[model samples]
Structure formats: structure tokens, C-alpha cells
Target: MALEIPRDRSPDSSLWLLRDGYQFIEKRARRYGTDIFDTRLLLQRTVCMTGAEAARAFYEHEALQRTGAGPARVQRTLFGQGGVQGLDGAEHRQRKQMFMSLMTPEAIQRLADFSAEQWQARAASWAAAERVVLLDEAEELLCRAVCAWSGIPLPEHEVATRTRDLVLMFESAASVGVKHWQGRLARRRGEAWVADLVRRTRTGELSQGPGQALATIAGHREPDGRLLDERVAAVELLSVLRPTVAVSRFIVFVALALQSSAGSRAKLEAGDLDPEWFVHEVRRFYPFFPFVVARAGEDFEWGGYRIPSGERVLLDLYGTNHDARWWPQPGRFQPERFRDWTGDPFTLIPQGGGDHYAGHRCAGEWVTIALMKTALAFLTTSIRYDVPAQDLRVSLSRIPAAPSSGFVMSNVHRA
Candidate 1:
């Protein structure tokens, strides 16, 4: 039977459902099979197969490609025409290779040392405050860590203001109207700042710190090939900066999870839980990048539905992560689900699968997981939440719905 796609919109369109977006997609996909729905501006499609199978197929399908126009248009408006995130194929790959060198195991270990020290220093200040907004504190820690690792001179006050503006730009990019306009303006300013930072680092004139990641990348060459062009290099650097900016949210979400879940909290506090298991559970349970954008590379068939070439597809990361077939008690948080289950890596992807998958499956996974583990270890054991516990509210349908406020922490004690 052919999957029947509904052309008519639902009263409460699944488009607006962010927090539980995956659940909604799953229900609809199961009912309609792999059908395509119209979203006025974009095409929405769903895949109902289990994680491993669906992810593999989704990755292999020739029809799946990035909508470069959207990213390109936005990047041009915000950062000019040269960053790696806006490029595709050979260009994007070349830029990524340059970045990969800066993110090596030894390099990351060095960065981690810097990050840990900054976290400790920042936490000292928070310990003295009678009442502290944890979100602000976490952002400051992340900003300082980025500067410390990248050799950017981000003053504390400037870091606070810029981080807020950059976050708003990302938020605005997701929707239309005034927010979108504001996001564009913010992005433009951010791009100029990023370009200047790259230029200064490349010239060996950037003040503060010796041999940071950005400086290394700026100076590095392929050996077999030529060094990356400054424009492409700057864009790649911005790519690094953009994601690291969100580290605060990742840190806050993991902290909130431990603080709210008594069982999970006890395990962490007692050191009974494996760090890998806890991290996986946090990735699974926490809402991050729920939807990723892709366009059909060529015409293809899936689940009895014929998807025409060049059609847009939004892979619901949140839905796939929580698929009941792949995940038992799909809605529940369980890291042990991955402990003994011998399965394909593609199925367990919180990041997208395959080397070719863009944006979501880049080289940042190891660094991100390591960072989360370190932050959580420090947070769960060292600090205590002062307020009565409350539900971490998220629109299940939204992508990347973390706690609106950074999970507030106050009563300071080393465990």
C-alpha cells in the first residue's frame, strides 16, 4: 500500500510541536507510512522503521542532500560568502580536515585542562553569591573556556552580551518575522568579530595564551596539499565557535537531569554509574537538535511511498532517538539500554549517522561527550540545588528544548 500523505494541515500542526516533536512524527509516520506532508515553506516527511535500519537507509539514499541554499543564504547575510558551514562537498570536506587537526586527542586534553581550570575559578565566584542564576554562570564558564582554548580575548562583560545576542540569532533563524531580522543583524556583527579574530590569530598578533586551537588551525597545512584559504578557514573557525557556544546549554541540561532524577543523582553522587552510560542517557533524554534538514538527492522509494527527487526531508532526531522499537519504554531515560546491547553504531546516534552526514555527525562527538562528563562530574558531586525541584518544561515538539533558565545551583560543597 502506498503511504497517504495529508495535504491539509492539522489544527495544531506538528510543525509547531518542538518538545515532543519526535513522538508526534512517529505517530503520524506509523499511521501514514513514509509519506510527505506540505509545510508551506518546507516538506516534512517521516520514516517509521527502527533506528538501525531507518538510519542506514536514510544515510544511504542518494536522494538525501543538504539544502545548501538556506544555509548559504543565511550565511551570506550573516557572515558573508566564505564559511565552511555554507559550503558543500569538496570545499566543506577540506575545511573540516583542517578543523580535525585542532580537535585531536592530545589537543583536546590540553583544551580540557584549560576548561577545568576555568570551571573551578568560575565556580569559586558562584560559591560566594547568595543567590546565583546558574545559566549566567554556566555561560560565563563556557565563554571563558572557549577563549582560553581558542585564544580569543573575550572580556567577561563582552562574553555575556555577545553570547546572549548569538543565542538570539540562532533562535531567530528558526522562525520568521522580527526575530529572523534580528538574528540576521546579530549574525552579521558576529561574523565581523569572527573574521577579525581569525585575521589576528593568523598574523601571530592575537594577545593572550600560546598556541590555541584557532591559532594552530590558522597556521596548519595539509602537507600533501595547500593550507585552507583564509575565508574558508574563518568559516570553519566560526563553525567551531557556534557549537561551543551551546556548551552551556548542554552542561545545564545534564546538571538539571541529575538534580531532578533522584535515582540518577544517587548513582552519580555514589560513583556507581559508568560515565558512558550516564552520558548516553543524557543525550537520549535531553532535547538537542530534534530536527535536521535534508533534501532528496534523487527520486527514491521508502516504506511504499515514492519520494520525488529534490524534495525536502526533515529527519526527526528526537523521534528516532525515542523510537519504541529501538528503545524499550521509549520515553523513559535509561543509559543501561546501551550497556550490553550489541548493535550497529548507526542506531545509537544522538549525532546523525555516517561520515557523509553533515553538521550533526562531525568530529565534535568525542569532545562533546568528554566535556559533558567532566562538567557533570564536577557539578553533580560538588554543588547542590537550593530550590525545590521542578519539572524541566520543554515543548516536546521543539528541537533542542533545554531548561529555559540554567539549572540553578547554590549550596556549594565538595563531595
Candidate 2:
């Protein structure tokens, strides 16, 4: 029994979307007391859904497709032109396996180790400086770590430029004006850099270690026995590098979360709380990306609402994590709740949800957790810094947000 969904009455709600940002879907859902609704965005009819159940339905293979799913602005900036996000059916499954192959236990452990080593090395310089901007430093440091882990050789001088470019892609994915253009420019430049690397690896000008991400992706074959185009291969590689650097944003929030809750911070410092749980809670509580977009595949009904074919749909990743239906006391910063988490995919989707290899869930989910936990291990156990007066407030209206102060700290020293 499909029913007509609640529709947003505001004419041209695109501006409202800009104003509300992350709460664009959840606030409306609360007002209508529904988990799903229909609206118009960018002059296109759009359907938005929230909550864990909505996630499950949204991710169902036959119900939606990734092709033409994301906005053109997002496509030009964040995901690039042709990457795994746009593929569907057999192509999607094949490309996804290439990413999942790099996420084995040994590989994930190596990423964690790299993060710890890089953080400690970077911290030495922090001690000598009067103030440290953790976000900036973390981006540079993560670029170094991920490059080494993925077997991509990066010249030391190019680190800052590459980090800035990657950050621009994620930071401006939702922007409208100059910053959005900046993201587009950065992506083009970044693709050229990696496309050359791919070309070199293919021609034996440079060597990649056995089973490395670069080697595998460069040599991978599609179901039809064809190689991905050089630029598309570059896009896939950025899928790894960009997200790893984006972890710096979550790293900043970890510091902010710990500061806001002294009990949790004290427990962390005392080695009483698990750093992994703290990392998970930070991902769950903070706003990363507001939503993920897909297109409705073959008309379907969910929660008694009709979802028509070819309509742009959004899954509220932020709202699902914060929904009181799954998270009790959703506004509270509680790391303990994660200790008993049952590993349900849709429940806490700071990253995307559903099957990793089989569905659209982020391929680097393990890599992200590994990176953040390593940072937590270093922050809580190894180093100490004083949080001086600064604007630590985060504006929810910003997609891919960080603390306004970039989580500034000073008086740094080894713990």
C-alpha cells in the first residue's frame, strides 16, 4: 500500500538547503513526523530518507542506482568524473573488489603503524613551534602516511600542495561559488599528477611493491577484460588518498570531543576507555557529510511511500547516525554506547552504509577507522598540548566541516 510522501511546501527550497545544510532532511522529517519526504532541489524533484530503516531500503540493490546519482557540482569536485561511485551491477562489483582487496588485516595494520610513525615524527616540529594548527599538519602528515602505505612515491616538496588540493576537493564539494571552482581546479591538477603515476607504473618507469594498491589498480581487469582509462584509474587512486587525508577532519573532531567531555578525556588519558570506542563515537556524533545521493531504480515503495523511477534521492547519513530511534540520548557525547555495538551496517553510518564489497558502502571504511584509532592512540597516550582560547565551535551548515579554529593548540610537549 504505497502512499504519497510529505512534500516540502517551500517554493525552490534549494536556498533553504544552503541555509540548513546538514539538517536539510532531518529537520523536515521531524516537522512532518516521517522518515521520508518529497521535495524540489536545484529544480529537480528529490526524495529524501532518514533513519536506519531508510538506509537499508535506500541501499537495496534493485531499488537504486549510483549512475547519475550525485549532483554535478559534487561529481566535478569530490568524486571526480568516473570512479567506483558511478558504477553499477557487474562493473561496480568488480571495481569494488579491487578496493576491498587492499583492506586485509595486514594491510590495515600497516596503515595504522604508518599513522603512528608519521604523527610522532610530525609532533617533533610541533614542540618547536609557538602554535600548532592540527588540521593543517594532519593533512600534510596523512598525505605522507597514505602515500607510503599505498606504494605511491611522493616527493617531499609536493606534500603541502597535494594535501591542499585533496582538502579542497572534500571541503568544497558542497560549495557554490569560488571555492567550488577551486575544488574543480584542484581535482583536475590532482588527476594529472596521479594519471602520470599510473602511466609510469604501467610502463615500468617506476616500481610498485607486490599487492600494493597502485600495482593492483594499475593492473586490474574489468569483467569484459578491459583496463580502466588512465584518468579513471587516477580517480580511483584519489578515492584512497583523498579520504585518508579527510580523516584529518575527524581527527580534529576527536580532539574537540575529548575536550568537551572531561570525564571521557580523563578516562582516555588514564587508559580506562578504549581509544577505538572514542574514535567511533567521534565519527558518529560529529557531522562529516550531510547525505549521500543515489537515483531511484525501477519504481519502488518504502515506508508506505511511492518512489518513482529516475528521481534523485538522498540518504541522510548524518541524521541516521543521530536518530534517537537507534541512538538513545542522541545529543549526548557517549563513547560507552559503542562498546556494545552489534556491528549493524545501517545503524551508525558516519561513512556510507550496507555491504562494503556488495553494496555502495565506502570501500575505505576499515582504512578510516585504522587511521583515526592510530591518531587517538597517539593523542591520548603520547603527546600533550594546551587548548588556548579559540573558536572551537563547528557550524553545522558547513558540509565536510571542521572546528572553526581548526582545533588550534599550543604549549605542546610529550606526555
Candidate 3:
């Protein structure tokens, strides 16, 4: 009495997934002419879905759950174990609220102000250099800014090394062999670094002012009224720092758009275009997070197919943002397309979609927007630079793709 979902012929599409990268889910869905399909990945049967409709279903909180949903490699690397990402039910809501509390407009603006200061300092230094790789500089810049804002003490000597560790955590999420092992090692070191801080805060050896993210996390108590484990507290704190550092990728993509898109820089400079449109388009058009993993919490029927409880499901974040149904002329990099965007949560999710407080949508999404706007404004209004001739092609085949040359710039000067 149930329709069969389209299925991939391969015994295991794990290799294909690694090969296809961001296009794995959407390409198969396009081949089948359906938004949903079942395939074997990592030798386990998994359901992949995309498009706006599928996103809506995938975010149905009661139907899908996060616990036991993430793979071991990802858990060990990208998402530390026992973080809010793995919680569900009331516990998730409570932890999510803790994160949301830090996103108040004033708090976000304070972080942006800190980042702007970093940009100013870094840009001044760039003026003296013959050439600079924006990706590398931006990561360190955000690393310093987020640490100051979060009240995490990042000493001058440890800046580069700490930034590299945070970068490896996300950059190596989809890598293999030595690269993957490096990410695991980085996570262990980073966690230990913060866990010690948490212990110090509790023992009165360290102190941070009220409202700082580190203080908030260290003091956060569960519903049953116990402070979070020091390791989990460290993981939660890193969740704030790591994602802010990851925004450097988006900042590079912004520079790429300014260099590549015709008249985009002119429009932005002339004040005829808003930076939000530019940021939104970059997030939608480019590949950042490939997909989000979840598991069915109970048996449910969608799109004429029955999904059994415990079935692994993948919601394509990049593909859904690029889906032609929600985004007309989806392949083009037109920022104007968002001029009248309907603000559909499911459609524009480069980060995961759904309610910020209720569902699993990213908590720091507003912070991403604010910091990107800060970067955009800085690159456009406060400085001038020449993007040297280099390989600017972005490969959809690479997980967490970036320009091969890392968006090189030369002759930077204050405007």
C-alpha cells in the first residue's frame, strides 16, 4: 500500500558521494525526476531529498531527530560529541535557547565591531605586503575577533596555530586518510584547550564578564539543574568560535563575487545594491555546507513513499538553495534575485533551514550575516585591492569548495 521511492542502482554510493560532492544528491534527484530517492551510502540504506518541499518535510521536528544521526567521523571532527547538535526534545530547546540568547542584536553588533577593528588592523598590514591570500588572512582575523568577543583568551603566540586547528576541524570534515586524521587530532587539542579554561572558570582561577559566550556556556545548567560537563561546555564554546572562523570562507567568496561578477562592485559601491543581497546570493550560489544528516524519528509517509523509523536521511542544503523551483535561473549569480525574496526558511538554507529557536536551524546565522556585511562593507568602502590573475574556478566536486588560489589579492591600500 506504499509507493516505492526511487533507488540508486549502486550497492554503495559512498565513493560516488565523495566523487560527486555537493552535486551527489541533486544530480540523482534530477536523474530520477523526483525530489526524493533512496541510496546506499557507507553500506547503509539512506534517503536523500532536496527542493523546497523536501526541505519542509525534512525539518519536521517531530518526524526527524538528530540523535545518532551524524556519522562517527563527522562527530569526532566537525561536531564534537555531547554538543547541542546531538540533543533532542526539551534538552535541545534548552541548549538552543542558551545559544540564541547570545545572538541578541546588540551582542552581534558588538562582535561585528570587534571584527571591523581586526579588518582595519589586518588591512593596514596588507598594504605593506606585496601580495596576500585573503582566505588565510580572513581566518586569522575572525579568529582573533571571535575570541575577544567570546571572552576566550587567545594569546598572540597561539593565534596562527589555534586558527589552523579550528580551520582543520571543518575543512577536514569531508577529507580522508592523513587529512582526516589531522582533523581528529586538531579536535582533541582544541577541546583540551577549552576544557581547561572551563575548569579554570569554575575554580575561580579565571573570570569573564557577564554575557560573554564563554561565561554563559560555563555557567549554563541543564533542566535537572547540573552544570554541563566540562568537555561538553568546551565543545559548546568551540561551536561558537569555529563557525565564526568558518565565515572566512564566505568572506573569500564575497571577494570572488566582487572580482568576477560584472558591475556588482559598481552597484554595491554606488549604494544601488544592498550587501545582504550579495551575501545571500553568494551563500546560495556557492558550495559551503553540502548537506545535513538526520534520522527518521518515527514511520512517516511523504511524497507517496513510506519512510521507516530509524532511516537515515540527508537534506541537501546546497542543492536545495540552487533548486530551480525556488530559485529561478538558479545557476546564475544574480544578487537581484533576492530583492523580493519571500524569506522562505527551507528554500534559502545554505545553513540548515527551519525555526531558529524550535527546529535545528543554525543559531549563529544572524552572526554570519552581520560579519559578512562587515567584511563586505570593509572590502568595498574602507579599502582597495587588486585581484591578481589566478585560478578562480570553484569545483563543485570538492567538499567545502574554495578557489584553488585562495582568492589572491595584491596592492591593498586604505581607500
Candidate 4:
């Protein structure tokens, strides 16, 4: 028997999508009393679903392909063209290997060391200032840390300019009007900037030490034995770079959680909880990306609903992370909930989930965790600061939302 998926009966729902942000699909699921629903977004038919089952199905290679899946606006900003995030099957595996190679334990430790050193140096400067916006500070710190780790030399003078540009690319990834256009501009400028380095690398005009990401990506060849276009290589580099910086946003949430959730913060201060658990809770509790988008690779059905090939589908990442069924007392901030965590990729995806090698799961998730843990250690046991009175609210309507005041602090010194 053919299944009848619930349909959102309304005109084009692009406005609703923009308005609702993280909760768009979950709101519909609640209203229709079903996890699967059909609606029109941006004047095109789309399917939206949530939960672990939905995610497992969405990531299956045969059921979905990433090529031509995302919106042009997102491609132009957040993802860039021809990066591994857009590839499928053999090509995806081949490209993904280039990225996964950089995730060795030694390399990730270097990321932690780089970020930790940068954070301490920045905190020293913050102590002299009357007030510091944590969001701004963390972004610049991460930009430099990642650049150094990747063997991309960032001149001290260019740090501020380059960091803000990268932030705009991800922050404006879901915005419209001036901000959206600014994101587009950032991607163009950033791509050109990295493309030059790729060119220099191939010609031996630039030299990078062994195991650095810049050198690895430059030398990587496709399974067909062709080098990536300079622009595409740049895109893949930014794919790693941008997300590492974006971890700063999660760091800000770490600060917020330290302030808002007294029990969790106390645990951290007492050294009773592992930073990983707190970071996991932070990833789950806060909103990063509202959803992950993909197009159907082939005809398929789940829960009796038939999905035709080429259908646009969105997995509600934020919804699934906060869903009460998977997360008991879902609204509460409790690090203890993750103590028994078995590493179910589908359940705890602040980044995309599944096998990192073959699937679209974020290649740098461990890096995000390592960096977040390092930041947490600095916050909990190393640094001392006072959270000033400000609006610390996170708006769900904003894709990749952070605190309203960017989590400002003052009076910083060694803990």
C-alpha cells in the first residue's frame, strides 16, 4: 500500500523556513503528529524528517547523493564548490581520505596545543582591556591556531581582517539581504586568497613541512589521477579551516553554560566531570546548523512514505539533538547524561553523523572536541573571568545562533 505523508497545506513555505529556523520541521511534526511531512520550500517540494532513524536513512550512500543537493546560496558561502562535502561514492571516498589523513592523533594534539597557547596569549591581552567580547576573541584565536596547524602562514597583521571575513562566511551563511551578500563576497575573497597559495605550493614557491594540511591537500590527487582545481583545493582547505573556527561559537556556549547551568559549571570547577561530556551537552543544547540538506540519490521509502529520486530532503539536525526521546529532560543542561554515551554517531551530531571515512560526517569532529575540551580546561581550571550582565539568550530563529551579547567577560586572569 502506498503511504500518505502529511502535507503542510499552505503556499510557498520559504518564509516559514526562514522564520522558524531550527524548529521549522519539528514544529510541523508536532502539529501533524508525524515525523515525516511534505512541504514546499522556496517554491519547490521538500521532505523534512527528524530522529535517529531519519538520519540513518538520510546518510545511506545509495539513498542520497550530495552533488547538486545544497542551495546555490549555501554552496557559494558555507560549503564552496567542488569540495568533499559535495562529492558522492568513489569520488567522495577518495577526497575524504585526503581530509581524514590530517586527523592523526599527533595532528589533533597540535590543534589543542595551538589553541591552548593562543587562548592563554589572548587572555593575557584581555586582562588589560576593560571588556572583551568572547566571540570576537575566540574567532581570531581559532583562525590563527588553525592556520598554523595547517601550515598556512598567517601574517600577524592580516589576522584581524582574515578572521572576520571567515566568520562572516559562516555567520551569514543563512542570512539574507546585506549579510547574505556579504557572505558571498567573503567566499569569493577567501577562495581567491587560498587559491593563490595552492598555486604557489604546486610550483614550489611555497614550502610546507610534512603532515601539514596545506601540503597534503595540495599534493592530493583524485582517484582518476588528476589534481584538484586550485579553486576546489582552496574550498576543501576552507572546509577544514572554517569549521575549526566555528568551534569558537561552541566555546562561547561553553562559557554560557558555565554561567547559566550552575550544577554543570560547578562540576567543571571541581574537576568532577570530563570536558568531553560538557562539550557533548553544549553541542546538544545549543544550535549550530539548523539542518543538513541533501537530495535523494534514488527512489526510497521510510515509514511508508515514498521518496522519488531527486527529491529535496532536509534532516532536522537541531531537532534530533534536542528531541526528548533521545535526550531525557531534553531542556536541561546536564553533562552526566553523556556519561553512559556509547558513541552513537546519529544521536550526538552537533556536526553531521555516521562513518567519518565513507559518509558525510564531519572530518574534523574530533578536532572540534579536542579544541572544545582545551577551551573548557582553560575556562574551568586555568582562567578567571567575570561574566558581565548582558543578554545571553540564544535565538532559535537565527541559524547558527549564539548568545545575544556574544558572551562578554571582564577581569580576566589566571584561575
Better of 3 and 4 by lDDT: 3
Model 2, residue 129: C-alpha shift (Å):
0.7
Each model's TM-score, in the order given? 0.84, 0.98, 0.99, 0.98
Better of 3 and 4 by TM-score: 3
Each model's lDDT comes to 0.62, 0.90, 0.92, 0.89
Assess candidate 3 and give its TM-score to the true structure. 0.99
Task: List model 3 lDDT by residue over 183-215, tens digit each.
Answer: 999999999999998898888788898889988
Off by over 4 Å in 2: none
lDDT at residue 408 of model 2 (Cα atoms) = 87
Query: Native-vs-model 4 lDDT?
Result: 0.89
Model 2 clashing residue pairs (backbone): none
lDDT by residue (1-415, candidate 2, tens digit) is: 7888999998678999988988999999999999998899999999999999999988875879998888889989999988999989888999999999999999999988988899999888888899999999889999999899888998988988999999999988989899999999999999999999889999999898977888888888878888788999999999999999999999999889878999998998888898888888999999998998999878988877889999989999999999998999999999999888998999999889999999989888888888888888788778999999999988988887888989888998999
Cα error, residue 96 of model 3, in Å, equals 0.6
- Candidate 1: segments with Cα more than 4 A from true spot: 1-24, 33-51, 67-82, 207-211, 216-232, 356-360, 389-391
lDDT of 4 by residue, 282-336 (tens): 9999999888888987888887889888889999899899888899988899899
Model 1, range 263-379, lDDT digits (tens) per residue?
877876777778778887787777676555666667777756666666666555666777677788977877667678664656566667666334326567666777787787777
Q: Please report how far candidate 3 places residue 297 from its true position, in Å.
A: 2.2
Clashing pairs in model 4, backbone N/Cα/C closer than 3 A? none
Worst 10 contiguous positions by lDDT, candidate 1: 40-49
For every model shown, the clashing-pair count is 16, 0, 0, 0
**Model 1 alpha-carbon miss at residue 6, Å:** 7.0
